[model samples]
Target: MSPLSALKISLPLAALLLPLSSTLASPPLVDPPAVPIAYSLEEFRSAVRSGGPGKDGIPAIDNPRFQSAEQADGFLDDEDIVIGIYRHGEARAYPQRILVWHEIVNDEFAGEPVSITYCPLTGTALGFERGDTELGVSGKLVNSNLVMYDRATDSEWPQILGVAIDGPLSGKGLEEFRVFWTTWGQWKARHPDTEVLTDQTGYVRNYRRDPYGSYRPLRGYYHPDSRRLFPVMTDDERYPPKSMVLGVRTADGAIAIDKDALREEEVVDVSLNGSQYTVVHDPDLDTGWVFHNPDDIEIEASNLTFNAEGVSGSGLENLEAVNAFEAMWFAWAAFYPETAVYEGGEAL
Candidate 1:
């Protein structure tokens, strides 16, 4: 079946096309006092052409169940990947095994409503504050990233961008939280008291196997040399499509620091648009974090540690955190085509 036609099999015929086309084409000339759509029909169609199982083909875990780290030891292996979040003195780990299927987890953390999302296709894991709203999979893929929708406004939010592209809340961006993509063993080593998401989800599925492939075994779509499953808006040959990077963006522009290069350098200082920022890699956890250098602190090559509290070492204290996330090179380049790439700590 054609990509467009295949979408109809799982989505309501009207829901699959009409709303998206109308929202993208143009808002009524009359002032409805609502936020105007942020993108054009061509842009919307370019990103959201095909549809998966309508809304919630893969159900989100709303009332998530968790177990102690020690209790989760049996199912999760040491090298299994997970997204770790620590806030307000609370810590939680969302395993990739679970996220690969649900895509989104609407839950509360540290008494605040947050959405933990992962798109296996693009290798992007993000956390966002929902405020009074909740997020779910819209069954749409834009630039090979998951498209999310809010329960309150029903606006579509492409996960990587974190902004509402359609519906009443268009142009609104969700508040993001820091979520680290790391191995289960590394996370447990740092946050021993962390609560791990359990597999007792209401929906029944094969939790033992992943649809995309295994990261530990490095098989299927996740293999280093595997090609992207879907077409992206743009393709840049500067980096491999599946190459991982610590991506950061500002009003001026976006920058992607090669994760592998960061690991080699351990600490790389970057300057973008006259603002200095430091990208530090934690060798132990195999994760990277970016912090704005308001004081122009000179970071040296050393063993670094980054947490919600910020990076370690002198002169780097109290640095404001820059919103950043780990993403595949292709997805980052697709959304920010003009982005500058940081290769071996130098802009290339």
Candidate 2:
């Protein structure tokens, strides 16, 4: 694996052009992982919004929290990002003594108070937002996979991908060894007659590794709900129209394909949420627009590119690489290369 390390691990968007400060850190954990569900940022944005909470308050990151860690930018440049604040509906674990030296923070979790920035090196998690300018030359290094993002629009969602635990007990504070390794993963799926006690030396064989979520495991955003849902395309094979909501528009530059079957006052002068868009329908590369709100999918085309060439990121067709626990579904070949959808049981 050395064609420049296979093009630096096949450019996963070149890990978003690095420089949030040089990145490449990990070293902490002699015991970390113990707040299994205590949240309170409006229930972490109503549990990442499958929609359900919000009584008021909790969602801040107005600036100057971009990682100097809780505040101590003495040099080794701070940036840990990957925080949580969710209260009930489960999701509470900060144990590496607050992810060791405060990595990154925008805050809030599960009850749906979103933004969880964490990038352990290309493992990717632009899921939340709040701040930063990058690294190198002039000696700068912010790098904070200490997660927490999206304070209303920088879009963030990376939880655990790189730097699982970096260094000889980096700062020590393993809350009862991360709540006994997450109650032993909810006691091995609600106790399959329980047994795995593992000769306890602060038991660290497989770590917390997703105590719930049925089985998801771990990666960037923690993918699993069909990779975060969204990929409905067709033009006529047997049905040709399932639709959950897919739109596309761009005036003068010519590229308008809204068609959610058409209707929004018959498309007269359509304007959806402050315009400036780029929504290319990828009907079948396994799955594409399920980003209910990647800040409302925009790309005012200044060459906002994404020619998946042969395609991937796991919209699942032939498939080759997709590790955020897979989320994609682009198929587009049932027959509509230009247009065709009658479905009234055949009409020549």
Residue lDDT tens for model 1, 296-338: 7777755455554546876566777677788888888888887
lDDT of each: 0.77, 0.23
Tell me the lDDT of candidate 1: 0.77
Tens-place lDDT per residue, model 2, 1-348, is: 112333665465566645432343322222333212122223322333211111111111222122212222221111212222222333332322222222233333232222333222212222322123211011111121122222222222213211112223222212110011122222223222322211122212332332212222333323322232222222223322222122221111111233332222111122233332222222222122211122333322232233323222322222221111111111111111222221122211
Candidate 2 — which residues are off by over 4 angstroms?
A: 1-208, 215-270, 274-278, 283-285, 289-348
Candidate 2 global Cα RMSD:
22.5
User: Which runs of model 1 end up more than 4 angstroms from their true locations?
Assistant: 1-42, 301-310
Sequence-dependent TM-score of model 2: 0.19
Candidate 2 local accuracy as lDDT?
0.23
